[model samples]
Structures are given as C-alpha cells and as structure tokens.
Target: MLWRSPRREDAYEIHELVRQCPPLDLNSVYNYLLLGEHFSDSCLVAERAGSIEGYVSAYIPPLTPEVLFIWQVAVRESARGAGLGGRLLQRLLARPAMGRIRYVETTVGPDNAPSRAMFLRLAGHLGAPVHESLLFDRSLFGPDAHDDERLMRLGPF
Candidate 1:
C-alpha cells in the first residue's frame, strides 16, 4: 500500500470508507474535506492499485501541539488484519510534521476490542504506557444511542 497525505478529492471516498467500517462514527464529507485541505499534514491515506484502502484522520490540537489527537482510523475490509492499522499509525508518526508529537490520543468504545487492541499494540511499539479515562459518556450523546467513549493516551515517546 502507498501511504501518503490525503487529498481534498479523497474526502467522499474516505467518508464512504468510514461508513462501511461500522461502529466508527461517520462524519460529513465536508469535515473530511477540511481535514484534507487544511490538516493534510496530520492526516494520512493508504492506497493500492489506485484504490483507497485505509485512512487516518488526526490533528495537532492548537493549544497542544505535542499531542496528536486521532479522530478516526478506517481500513477497508479487504485490507483488514495484516497490521495495516498499526502501520498506518506508525507512518503518521514518522512524518516530519509530526516530529514533535509526544502524545497520541484517541477515544475508543468499551466493546470495540479491535480498536482497543490496535491502540495498545501501538503504545507497546512506541515503548509508551497506556492511560485511559472516560472522555464521553453514552448519556452525552443525548437520545442517539452511542457507546461511552473512553480516552486512550499513549505517550511521551
């Protein structure tokens, strides 16, 4: 797979990828367009044979440049397993723009074992410890049924 920064034209496809990857909240294509156009430095996409296989949406918070808050990770079913998720993350951190990033933060639902495991493996590979806390309670989603989102912080590496 060719890992590279996302392009604005990839927004619709990325949105569709997220939509197919269930359990992951799908955001508006406009949101992805903004990330691609403005935060491309912090976002990444993997393509093979001219097909988008995976994508990771992340950004360095304005007040905390050292922290990379990953918004979403989506890998097509055909590309599942084989460590594509972890590789995507490693590739993201390896970018020159992410040189100062010391902490990686993401939210995972309690029952999302695949996501939780992928993040834990990333922390291990970074030689960092994992710290987790409740970031968003299910109740905060109001009437929309949603799982409680817990923050996962892997850091200072």
Candidate 2:
C-alpha cells in the first residue's frame, strides 16, 4: 500500500473507511474535507491500487504545537493486520510539518485493543514513554451511548 499524506479528494473515501469501523466517531464528509485540506501535513492515507485502504486524521492544536492530537485512524478490513496504521502514523510524524512535535495524544475506546496496541508499538518505535488516562466519558456521548475513551499519550519525541 502507498502510505502518503491525505488529499482533499480522499475526504469521502476516508469517511467511508471510518464508517466501516463501527463505534468510531463518524463525522461529516465536510469535516473530513477540512481535515484533509487544512491538516494534510498531519494526516495520512494509504492507497492500494489507487483506492484508499487506510487513513489517519490528526492535527496539532493551535495552542499546543508540541502535541499532535490524532483524531482518528481507520484501516480498511482488507488492509488490517498488515501494520498499515503504524506506517501511516510514522510517516505523518516524520513529515517536515511535525519537526517540532514533542507529544502524541489519542483517545481509544477500552474495547479497541488493536488501536491501543498500535499506539504502544508506535511509542516503542519512537523510544518514547506512554501514559494512559480516562479522557472522554460515556456522558460525553449522551446517555451511555458509547464506551468511554481513554487517552493514550506517547511523548517527548
């Protein structure tokens, strides 16, 4: 798979990929377009034979330039277990725009073992420390609609 920064044209396809991964906070295509266009430097997309197979949407919060807050990661079922997620992440952080990044933050659902494992592997690869904490409670989803999201921090890189 070709791992590269996401393009505006990839917005819809990336949105589809996110929807396929149930329980992921599905967002509107417009929001995805914004991410692709405005945060392309921090976002990544994997293409296989010209089709989007995986995507990682992330951005550096304005006041927190040292932190790269990963918004979402979605790999098509056909591309799972191949470590595309890690590759996409590494590439995104290695980009020139992330040269000053010192921390990586992401929220993972308690049941999402794959995502947790991927982030752990990333932390190891970067030789950074990892910390976990409750970041988003079920109440944020209104009426216990979804599981709480735990924060995963890998840093000082």
Candidate 3:
C-alpha cells in the first residue's frame, strides 16, 4: 500500500471509506474535499493500484500549535488487521510540516477498544507520554446523543 497525503480527487473515495467504517460520523463529501485540498499537508491517504484504501484526517490545532489533532481514521474493511490505520497515522506525523508538532490529540468513545488500543500502541512506539481525560459529555450533543468522548494525548515526540 502507498501512504501519502490526500488530494481533492481522493475526497469522495475517502468519504466512502469512512462510511464503510460503521459508527464513524460521515461528514459531507465537500467537507472531505476541503480537508483533502486545504489540510493535505497534515492528512494522509493510503492507496494501492490507484484506489484509495485508507485515510486519516488531521490538523495542527491553532490554539495549541504543538498538538496534531487526529480528527478521523478509516481503513477499508479488506485492509483491516494489517495495521493500516496505525501506518497511516505514523506517516501523517512523519510529514515534514508536522516536524515541529510535539504531540498528538484525539477523542475516542470509551467503548471503542480498537481505537483506544491503537493509540496506546502508538504512544509506546513513539515513546511518548499518554494521558487521558474527559473531553465531551453526552449533553454536549443534545438529543441525538453518543457516549462521552475522552481526550487521549500522546506527546513530546
């Protein structure tokens, strides 16, 4: 698989990848287009034979320039279990523009064990400190509620 930054043409493909990863909030394709075009420097996409197979959308938050907030990571079902998601993240953080970033931040549902484990493994591989704290409560989403999202940070890398 090829790991590289995303492109506008990959937006629709990325959106479909996200949809196949059940339970992930499917953002608008236009939003994905902007992400691919505007934040390509920080995001990553995995492809094989010209077809998109995985994506990880992230950006360095303005308020905390040292932190790269990973907004979303989706891997094609057929590509799962070979660590594609983690590879996507590792490559994204390896981008030259992200060299100054000292930390990674993302929120995950407490029950999402796969994601939770992935970050833990990343922290171990990066040899960074990993900390967790409450990020959002159910009330924050009003009625169409989801579980609390806990903030996970791995950093000073």
* Number of the predicted model whose TM-score against the real structure is largest: 1
Q: How many backbone clashes does candidate 1 have?
A: 0
Overall lDDT per candidate, in order of appearance? 0.93, 0.89, 0.87
Query: Candidate 3 residues 1-157, lDDT tens each?
Result: 7878888788888888898996688999999999988888988888899988888999888899899999998888888888888988888887789878899999988788888888888999899999899999878988996888789999888
Q: How many clashes (backbone atoms < 3 Å, residues ≥3 apart in a chain or on different chains) does model 3 have?
A: 0
Model 3 alpha-carbon drift over 4 Å, by segment: none
Error of 1 at 109 (Å): 0.6
Q: RMSD to native for every prediction?
A: 0.7, 1.2, 1.0
Candidate 1: regions farther than 4 A off: none
lDDT of 2: 0.89
State the local distance difference test value for candidate 3: 0.87
Clashing pairs in 2: none
Q: Which ten contiguous residues of candidate 1 have the minimum total lDDT?
A: 1-10
Clashing pairs in 3: none
Alpha-carbon TM-score of each model against the true structure = 0.98, 0.95, 0.96
lDDT (tens digit, per residue) of candidate 1 on 1-157: 7889998789999999999998999999999999999999889999999899999999999999999999999989988988999999999999999989999999998999889999999999999988999999899999999999999999989
